[model samples]
Target: MDVRISKRRTTGQMSVFELDALREAFRRSVRENNVTEVQWAEHAERFVKSMIRKESRGIQA
Candidate 1:
């Protein structure tokens, strides 16, 4: 299966509250389920489709 992975980096001083919120969400997700070992090839396919759909909707709006 064809696959694509996109990565990005942002450089800035993030607020403490924003950082804490992100950390909390990650902790919650990990506590809820073990997502570390799943096969992600299919997930990537769905992710790309979802992003495209969202972008098209934003454009239409």
Candidate 2:
């Protein structure tokens, strides 16, 4: 946890928001067994993108 380390996502790695999406997807999978792969993927994508958007909006000089 060094301040100098870059926060940017590395290639082939998941971001914190994406990881959270996975966690949510897993839970939804268990609860909604009928969910399709396409639907699940969209959910994860939306979750991560929305969180990133929200986080970026909070940044200020």
Candidate 3:
């Protein structure tokens, strides 16, 4: 699977540590499922959005 991180406008920038964590999460997802590329992308997008929302709300994600 090709895992690419696109540069886009977000509520805030993620630190290197956060990005690494996200990458690991994606890898775990891949390991647990046989998802298509599109599905993987969607999953990643949702995860990122949730993270941003949680941060904005001052909650742990």
Candidate 4:
């Protein structure tokens, strides 16, 4: 967590129509699940712990 990493996704010169389609796809996924705020935090914590365990074992998450 101490290390900082910054990355950007740059798709070279796409049309507005193409951009709209991509944006819509992302929005759809974000709304696909209906998790409450508390549930989300719980899931997130569990995911982080799982990731740490996986890394300790040198396995892909």
Clash totals for all models, in order?
0, 0, 0, 0
**1-61 per-residue lDDT for model 4 (tens digits):** 1122111113235467856875575445446655466566665566557645764585332
Candidate 4 colliding pairs: none
For each candidate in turn, the TM-score is 0.40, 0.40, 0.48, 0.36
Best by lDDT: 3
- C-alpha lDDT score of every prediction, in listed order: 0.52, 0.62, 0.67, 0.51
Q: Which one is best on TM-score?
A: 3
Better of 3 and 4 by lDDT: 3
Flag the better candidate by lDDT, 1 or 2.
2
Deviation (Å) of 9 in candidate 3: 14
Predictions: Cα RMSD each: 11.3, 5.4, 9.8, 10.9
Per-residue CA lDDT of model 2 for 5-60, tens digit only, reads 23543334666887787688666754666656657777657666876687568543
Instruction: Write candidate 3's Cα lDDT for 1-61 as tens digits.
Output: 2122223233345568878987897788767776677697787787679766876585332
> Against the true structure, candidate 4 has what lDDT?
0.51
State model 2's lDDT.
0.62
